[model samples]
Structure formats: structure tokens, C-alpha cells
Target: MGLSKRRAHLRKAWFKKGCVSPKKGQTVAFPTVADNEFVRFEKKSFDRRVHTSNNVLTFKDTDGTDTTVSALRPRPNASNVVDEYSGCGDESLYPDLCTNKLMVQAKVQALFYSSFKEHRQDKPNCEGDLNFDAAYSIKWGLGWRELLKCTKCSCMCDYHNLYEEVENKKRSG
Candidate 1:
């Protein structure tokens, strides 16, 4: 039978057998539900909803490669709002955003001083790795990778460049 028809039959059978509302002091046998199938269905539905949303931002470079930048990552704090730094004169902006401005300046120093490789093979991913590199650079001295500004988009996508470089190499090979 079709899935919908089977589900309807199961629903009717469940209702008929009092699975929906058990009698007083009586045990009810419920119809079996596949957890994996249910989870897969839910994930598919959620993915559809996310992809259809207006909040999703996509960027296409001059090379015609589509890059999607969707979803704002929340701060480590419990609150939905990102953490702000009062020191930046404009208290409204997140500290991390303010830090990027400093990073832009520091990149000039790195260009002359740092011996970090021009192309990094191990491109960083995950919040921990990204944050860890950013965090440690202040105390541990300047690293090789400088936050390179994209001439096309004018966005400070340091990691994005690394990933793109790796992808280009793979395609050429």
C-alpha cells in the first residue's frame, strides 16, 4: 500500500484499538513508528523551510561560482543577541565585528613580518577552530594567514579564500 494510505490505516487502527485514549487501568498497544524514517522526514521538511526562507543570502563571484552565506551564528552566551564591546565608541556593534577592523590593520603588519605560508592546506572550519585561531593570535604573536579582503566583493573573507584556493587546486588536478 501507499505510505499515506498505510499511515491512514494505522491511524484508524490505532484509534479503533483505543491507543489514542486508553481505558482506566488498561494497557494500550500503540502502532510501531519508524524513528529513522520520522527523523529523515522531519530533517527534509526543515531543510526545505530553511532553503525557502528570505533570510538566506547568496553571493556569486566574477568566476560565476555561487557562494551562500546563510544564518547568523549566535554568540556563545545564552541570549540570542551577539556580544558587544563598549570600548569601540559605538557600543551598538558586536565586539567580533569591531575586531575585524583591527584585523584589517594588522594584516598590513603581517604582510611585511609574518612568515606564514601563502597557501594553507588545512583550511579552518567549525566555530572552535575559527575562534581559536583568532583568539590565540593576539597573545601568541602574529600567524601566517592574514585577513585578505576580496577585491570583487570587498568582504573580509580570510577563510573563504583558503577554501577557494584548495578547491581550485583540486579542480585543476
Candidate 2:
């Protein structure tokens, strides 16, 4: 299949930023995020030059308003995006999700779903942090160890490799 739905959405969003051909060793700001964020595209190496991966994306924070940028919710085709102040439901008391930490969490959650896929699958009826439950974790065969590993590499290779392995096993079986 072509890129998965989420992956395609990310690519479309990235491309909409007018990233036609990012020069080598050049830094470009992702238009989806605020102007301070910088993403450095990788240089094409020797043999596998066709496949270049951008591994360095940096966020530059300035002290003032606009400390955080809101992600585009209700993904273009998504029908279930809720109107919540904060996904963690702490906004009523905390009231400050614009902090750097929460910004990072939101970005990570948006870009990497492999780590949260099990939770999302288990709690399809719920939104935000409520999707993560002990019962769902147990039913999905995920625990602290698996969670740790997923968090470590879900944005990169671990999840893809595991998916491929499972696909291969299914095909062979």
C-alpha cells in the first residue's frame, strides 16, 4: 500500500510547507509549526543516496508570547476530533498547556503513533489520556517494558521493523 494514512497526512502537511527540494546541510522551518522550529535535511551519502533521511529537527524557543503552536486538530478527514481544552484534562486547574513540556508531548504524540497505537486501538471510544488504561495495556500485551522500547524508537525504526516482521510471519503462516 501507499504510505499509511497518518504518514500520508504528515507528508502532505510537510509538502504543503513548500519543501520541494531542501538543500544539503540547510535548515528549514516547518511551516506546520511556528517559525522558531528548524528541521535540517540530511545530505545524500554514497551508495544509498536515493534514500535520505532528515534526522535533525530542532525547535528554537524565544521568551515571549507564541511559546507554543497548536497542532491542526480534526485531521482533514477525521470525524472524531473533540473540542477539549487539554487532552490530559488538567487545563481546568493547570490552565497552562502552552508550556514547553506539553508542547513537546503534543508534537511527539502527533508525529509518532506506533507507541500509542495499542492504547488508541483499545480505547477507541475515548479521547486523550483516558485512552491509556491498565486493562487495555494488559489486553494488548503492552507493559512498561514494551512502552519503554516503543517510546525509544517508535518515531524511527522499531515499530516499522516489528510491523514488517509480523506481516512476514502472517504471510508465511
lDDT of 2 by residue, 1-173 (tens): 68899998888667445456556589888668445432222232111122224963222233323323222212233233553433556544333232222123443354357645654564455444422211211112221211212222232112221111123345554
Best by lDDT: 1
lDDT of 2: 0.34
Candidate 1: the clashing residue pairs are 116-144
Q: Which stretches in model 1 have alpha-carbon errors above 4 Å?
A: 1-28, 32-49, 53-77, 80-82, 86-97, 100-173
Expressed as tens digits, the lDDT of each residue in 99-151 for candidate 1 is 54223444454442322233222332212111213322332222224343322
Q: After superposition, how far is residue 53 of candidate 2 from its true place, in Å?
A: 66
* lDDT against true structure, model 1: 0.37
- Worst 10-residue lDDT window, candidate 2: 156-165
